[model samples]
Target: MRPLIRPKMIVSAVLAALVLAGCASTPEPPPAPESTSAVEQWAALEATELIDQLEALPLDERPRDVLASVRQDEVVVSAADGSREVSVPIQDGHYLSIAPYLDRTHDCFFHSLTTCTGEMGNEELTVRIVDDRTGEVYVDETARANDNGFIGFWLPRDVAATVTVTGVGGTAEASVQTGAEDLTCLTSLQLT
Candidate 1:
């Protein structure tokens, strides 16, 4: 004779089936990352009013070399004053000249861009500058943009070089020649 099926057994079977079905269902995909706004990106570099001061210097007093990096929202000026950090809006080509010669040792300025956050400014970057003439790695370093989204380097004047910048957002390479006179070579790299 067949045994009678109990109500509790049927309920237990149904619950087990439901649990297995729940486990089998696909999970939702993770949310996409939010893009940063221009204004928010400008704030990350901790930039200040340094450009204005740099621009205000008279031509005679200005340093011969000036390097500025241009980004989507802001310009990073390699020249900084003490702990004062400053940022300026980007221009047709963000250019400036400052005098009184702070640290004349460094003559090259490098800028790298991949992306930026409202909170952190421009993305951190690893840059490598190779001396094209001798195949020497002139500079290999990781750095964050100053308030103005610019990174600075000191290289011998009148040297040919190649710069490679890498970051989480992308990588870029550029070629430049150090100026015979103190000069600002603004190298902008697109991170992609």
Candidate 2:
């Protein structure tokens, strides 16, 4: 038996739609689902699975009441108002999500899986990431931005590094730390 649609294709379609919707303006934040069961369903999903779904959903289909953020140690899934929540420990490598922008950006302490926006959506940019201590180059290639105008990386846990993103806007550099208490979202870089 074969699946009707490949999972990658579904995700790509969703991302392309988001990028198109955001090209002229930022799409409205996903509204909370009407049923609390939506949150429960998300709670049942494993960390990576949950992250994948969260990254793939369209704004209208997202459960707005839940705020999902990935961190160094675990994924925090909670109600937007903080009335309920859960944490799923990360079992392996660390994943970092970054949104590099030119003129617009938002104040995000943690990257929200349901809502976070950046400029230059659907752009293929040159990205370079290096370990600050080991002098190892983790990534030296071109990565295309998802519809949300962000790129993600999988790295070994417990390290600090510098990140540079170069695109049509220009270039920008920033630092990242993957520690027990470090944030998983990087949106401070700006193209000059």
TM-score of each: 0.38, 0.72
Query: Each candidate: how many clashes?
Result: 18, 1
Give the alpha carbon lDDT tens digit for every residue of 1-192 in model 2.
986998999999999999887896966899987775556778788887887777756556777788887877677888888888888777887878888888888877677787786786678889898999999998899978766777777778889999998988799998888787777888888889
Off by over 4 Å in 2: 1-36, 81-83
lDDT by residue for model 1 (79-132), tens: 322232335554232231111111122233423221211211244768788889
Error of 2 at 111 (Å): 1.3
Identify the runs in model 1 with alpha carbons over 4 angstroms from their true place: 1-122, 181-183
lDDT of candidates 1 onward, in order: 0.49, 0.81
Clashing pairs in 2: 32-64
lDDT of 1: 0.49
